[model samples]
Target: MQATKKATINIALVGNPNSGKSSLFNALTGLNQKVSNFPGVTVDKKTGAASISPTLQANIIDLPGTYSLYPKSADEFVTYDVLVNPSGDEQPDMVLIIADASNLKRNLLFCSQIMDLKIPVIIGLTMMDIARKKGVEIDEAGLERELGVPIVTINPRKNKGVSELKKMIDLVAKEKQSVAPRDFIDSAALAPEVVRDIRQYVQVKSDYAALHVAVNHGELPFLNGGQKLAITNLLQANQFNKTKVQAEEIMQRYGRIKHIMKNTVVEADPLQKQLQTEKLDNILLHRFWGYVILLSIMFVMFQSIFWLASFPMDWIEAGFGALSGWLTNILPANQLTDILVNGVIAGLGGIAVFVPQIMILFAFITVLEDTGYMARISFLTDRLMRQVGLNGKSVMPLISGVACAVPAIMATRNIENRKERLITILITPLMSCSARLPIYTVMIALVIPNKLIFGFFNLQGLVMMGLYLLGFVMALLIAALLKLFISIKEKSYFIMELPVYRAPRWANVGTTMVQKAKIFITDAGKVIMIISIILWFLASFGPKDRMEKVTAHYEQLKTAHPEQSEALDMELQSEKLSNSYAGVLGHAIEPVIRPLGYDWKIGIAVITSFAAREVFVGTMATLYSVGESPEDNDATLREKMRNATWRDGSPVYTLASGVSLMLFYAFAMQCMSTLAIVKRETKSWKLPAIQFAYMTVLAYISAFIAFELLK
Candidate 1:
């Protein structure tokens, strides 16, 4: 027998930036959340299922943060579209508007706008503690009575008042409550004739909806061509001033907000004290000290990523190696055994070892974001970004690119200007991401000496920082150059609200770190595992005659000189690899990469890594037969790579080769995932093609120059 089913309720979480909306979402959804794109847009749609009661399940949609209904960026547009379009998938049964109690006047403006949309609204008032600390007190019942909406004071970070908020949402949704009786503005007065004319053709939800149609009918996707033309004709005929009307509407709403605050909120005394945020900003945002602190923070982040992750990485490597060895001993030796140990185990280990670094990096990023310094970074870098044909908003995506380009590129949706957004998307992948870190660490360990400079600085860490800086420099240079060619005349502005600095939310930070690391391992592990098996096959077998000849030659050598069996066995393996299909393909590209100080094996890695940058390590481990011994597997791979040589008996991974490889990866568009995302973002293959072509050329030239100079 089927169990009784519960009706699902959709609740939309809407708020302004830094309104504690995200914290509330995390608190409600916990670990049941999933992130995906909205139906036709790149804006992230975070949805999760939460149980409001034993028999009631709620599907929560956390919309992008927007200050007002008037959309500016892509994310805001997503929020606006979902709210206004009743037939859409994310059309919420109830709306929860998260507002900062400390900033009631400004928060109320948005709350007023949402109420005018005529949806079932519940105000989730957050940051009440901060308000109390500032000596600002709010009368929640008085405010609710005046607005005609339910108001719940919540501290989502501490799970306070969350149960009450859920109950209110359930009541509102089940009761099918009508829109609040209060109106924020006289929308009919703003554009009387235009609103009247538009409502005749379309089913308008409220007077404000009609006003929005009059102003933005041309851009609204739901409107038919005929309806849009009708609206356009009406606006033209009425000579409706959209700008003047919007300005008047905002002024009227703010006037009402001031009145509401006067009735329900008691403000802190002016002479009480400076805010904690203001006090912190005085030193943190100081012209000289801000830059110094920001730089120091970055330096420490990179250093810690390397230093703190070393022990965990070593442990993971050793554990994996021992497991592989144990498996090899227990299982009978065959092609299947070889594939299992050398291909799957080696591939998994290569990527798993980097989990520590990934976690550390994401943890640092999360802490920075939670503490509110991330916004300050954008504020500080805005002036410099504008000089490079970009705006301050571009800095976040660029900084985020250091983690991964896919999400960083997705982050560009917030950039309003098309040219600025395009340029930001194009150049973002140049920032050295964590995928490149595996390559950097492996190569640096091979070539760069691990030494302390000035007794306090890590020489390896400094080099890592230099590589990161190089990526940023190249990104800026490329943006400036692209700006010269792609000319679009549009005004750009950077208006950001800097939230007060708070102590890092350790739980949120830990969640972010674990989630990001899990994503990296699962995503990269899939690609690496598949490619490693294919590579193992191609490196293990060759043409029947050639395989036999190579085997016979080694057998003869071992028979003649029994004491040199180990050396002969190594020769046979090398010969078999050389004649295998993978070896043949590598040889085909070897000549092309020879001048860049790469051997045939590196050529293969370069080709396979088109799937993902991290696959290079797995490919190398498979080709080198790193699974032969289970113990000390991490060092085994490195030792094998160190001993690799050209036909001329010269070491392959010299300073020249290692540096060249790093430069190549730094500039190359080697990630197919990145290219696919670029295509999705631009909605054209032409841009990704251009991106791939230019990045390939840049990588080759940079690699060549680096190799030639060092060699």
Candidate 2:
């Protein structure tokens, strides 16, 4: 029997950041999506499938958003590579350029750059509702005539004109035709005889040739291999002239665009539209007031996550604990049940409990981005960012790094300066990620005394906020210092689109929150689950005689002391845990970590939790619970930890030790996912290795100093 063919059409969603590109991707792809690394780059490749028609399925790629074809950072290089390079798996059959209808000029500029590529191009005109509301009228036919690309005005949130977009794609794919040849140089500007002579001898006719002229004259860099050769040939033909051809090309295009825009584009009181957004922006983005407002908003976001989500977090933790208890009673006493409850259930549940926190963070981020407040934040913070030798664009990624360093690093694409972006990426992990939160929360609850800082604010919460601020301060200082060493001469400027103020799009926000949450729960969940099973195996079984001796010895100690037996039993169990397989492993690694004030059991938890920082709490729960098997009345993790001690009769978790541990986590390379992402982004094991080594050294030195000072 012959195999039936399945038709798959490839579509690329291209746009500038904050143009509702991601929202559209989520709408189109739904749940049928996969996130991977592009062939040789650390940039993320998001590919998803959607049914366009009964006979055709669309394989959609949400490419990294770029402002122009001139690549600046590593992320932009990846975006440029995937689109321009022919040797790729995810090349688009048709390019769907998404433009914000309200910001037609700026958006169209990017579209004009891509239109010259031979691929069939279509436009998804987003934010049409906002444009119409503002009395901005778009001549769709005029735009099509200017660019020769089909345009479909759609509100992605409302799901309007999406079918038309799909149909356009289907039709464009079937009939492969390039957009019209509108990209060209001013051959007419030259003398008639000179223009004719050059045209006949130059071996160039298209916009790509104009691009060469512009690049030679310092307009934009020559983009492709063909363009480079064409430039060389033109130079050779014209006696290797050193004129600013590239600069001339840029001015020529801009002049033409302005002319067309003036003739066709209609605005309902341009000054009024500009004023409407500016009125709100003036206060919000003021030098002093902007800082105050930004800080206040950040404070609210963090406070809401902790205070509001606490109820949900508690419910999740309690629910998981109850489920584990129920499973323990119902299942026969066996290794499998133990693994299921303590290892898989308890381990994974620890991460699940924090979903509310992650979701809240996402929700706030989405709202800020949707309402165009982020650009204002960037604009307001530019001076401060420049002082720190970084761009204002670096702010969002650094802030997002608090939630996760990996994505924050990926988010650095919008930064146009290469050196600045790299420096930002290097220091981002210094900001404590959300994965470190469980450990911080646990340790803070144990060590820090809850009292008001100035007889008003909660001391503990203030301390938490202090840690966050401290991280930001450190990042700024380090970046400033590092800038002195890395020599780069590119002029840095911040220019960003500040979209009109509008109510937050809940549909877009909700979709983003859920999609990111799902990715976190599933992708991180897999690594954690496997580690749980392995940890179970190591903790459960050991050498037969050693295990038997451990049990007999603990039982005998319990039998000897009647009143004090309970306490003695706990001590005996802790001792036996040091001799068990998992315990032995911790002991072997304990010497190396002893200077850092960590014991064998602590070492084991740290090592196991290297897979993910959040897993520290889960690792501690399983390691301590499995070894001690605390009685039903003393089931709380905090209570169990309170009773833990060293052989020298000192408490295991002291204020000094807790603070030291927190500092260690603050600077440590604990997240495996982060390492993987670093490798992807840098395209070399060398960078990841360097990152791991330096971070580890920093963690150790910081922890050592902290412990010694407190000791």
lDDT of each: 0.88, 0.74
Candidate 2 residue lDDT tens string, 566-602: 7777666566666778987988898988887788878
| Candidate 1 regions with alpha-carbon error over 4 angstroms | 1-5, 555-565, 626-635
lDDT of 2: 0.74
Give a tens-digit lDDT track for model 1, residues 1-711. 988787888889999999999889988998899998899777789999898876678899999998899999899999998888747778888889999998888888888888988888999999999999899999999999889999999999889999998888778877867368857788988888988878898886788888988888887888999999988889889998999999999999998888988999999888998888899999888889999999899899888877898899888878877787788778887778789888898888878888998899889988998899999999898888888899999999999999999999999999999999999999999999999999998898899998888997888888888899999999999999999988898999999989888999897788888888889889999999999999988988778988888888889889999999976776677788998888889999998999999999999999999999999999998888732333333345677799888777899999999999999999999999999999999999998999999999999999999999999
| RMSD from true fold, candidate 1 | 2.2
- State the TM-score for model 2: 0.84
In TM-score terms, which candidate is top? 1
